[model samples]
Target: MLRFFRWYCKPDLIEDIEGDLLANFHRTLRQEGPAKAKRKLAIQIILLFRPGIIRIFNLSGFQDHFKLIQHFVISWRRIKSNLTFSLINIGGLGVGMAIAMLIGLWVWDELSFNKSFTNYTELAQLYQNRTFDGQTGTYKIVPQPMSRD
Candidate 1:
């Protein structure tokens, strides 16, 4: 039972919890008998399987952050040793990001055009499809009277 408890309990908390369980087991052993004491000990160890007492399977951010920092230092050293390649890689990345940002902004502007009007939800643009010189084209410049005479 002690071995079973030690297997699943968090390392930092094992001593305190094991101490309590042992104390209870001894008290039960004296008050009742060895049979009841062993049963109570088994129940106590099984009950300690709650989330608060379990050791987390994952490495916490503290350890992972140190690993990330170490990897970044190694990469910086490589980048510093290869200056021209690093510059080319960085410039290409910057240009690609800039182009992507510009295209995203243009798309947002196109989607939001004429959206500030009071009746924007009800507004629609009328496009005309015509054949000019045997070439077909779609145009949005629909002419209409602006005011009544």
Candidate 2:
């Protein structure tokens, strides 16, 4: 993770930030347990997976800003020249992203089902087996107490 962080971090801020992270990791390890320290380090590294934290590709010194503006201008001109194709691409991308977001939310909710309850740990789904038409079937809809308490 640290190696990935080094590869991903902005080149200008790598040295000082990496050193500080290492120092903080060691401090956390000493103050807290290994699990907490590892969690902290992992969280920090994950947080760096953002565009602002990633290294910029610009290498030119003074012309970088001009290059950026020129790049945007060229992009805008291309889009304008291919307005129909560009709109279609943008619409497809927007629909795909919206569908992906909705699926992600659904999966998150399903995984976290019943987690909001204070006594979720004590709760359990009850199941029962019954014979119907010479066949045995199991069902989770049986009426039963969720917890012993």
Instruction: Specify the highest-lDDT model's number.
Output: 1
Model 1: residues with Cα > 4 Å off, grouped in runs: 1-59, 118-142, 145-149
lDDT of 2 by residue, 16-110 (tens): 88888889899999999799998999898898689888987656766988898999999999999999999999999999999999999999986
Clashing residue pairs in candidate 1 (N, C-alpha, C atoms within 3 angstroms): none
lDDT for each residue of candidate 1 in 1-149, tens digit (9 for 90 to 100) = 89878877899999999999999999999999999999999988887899998887776888989999999999999999999999999999999999999999999987887898976665567788999999999999756744342
Best by TM-score: 1
Cand. 1 Cα-lDDT: 0.89
What lDDT score is found at residue 137 in candidate 2?
97
Displacement of residue 94 (Cα, Å) in model 1 is 0.6
TM-score of 1: 0.46
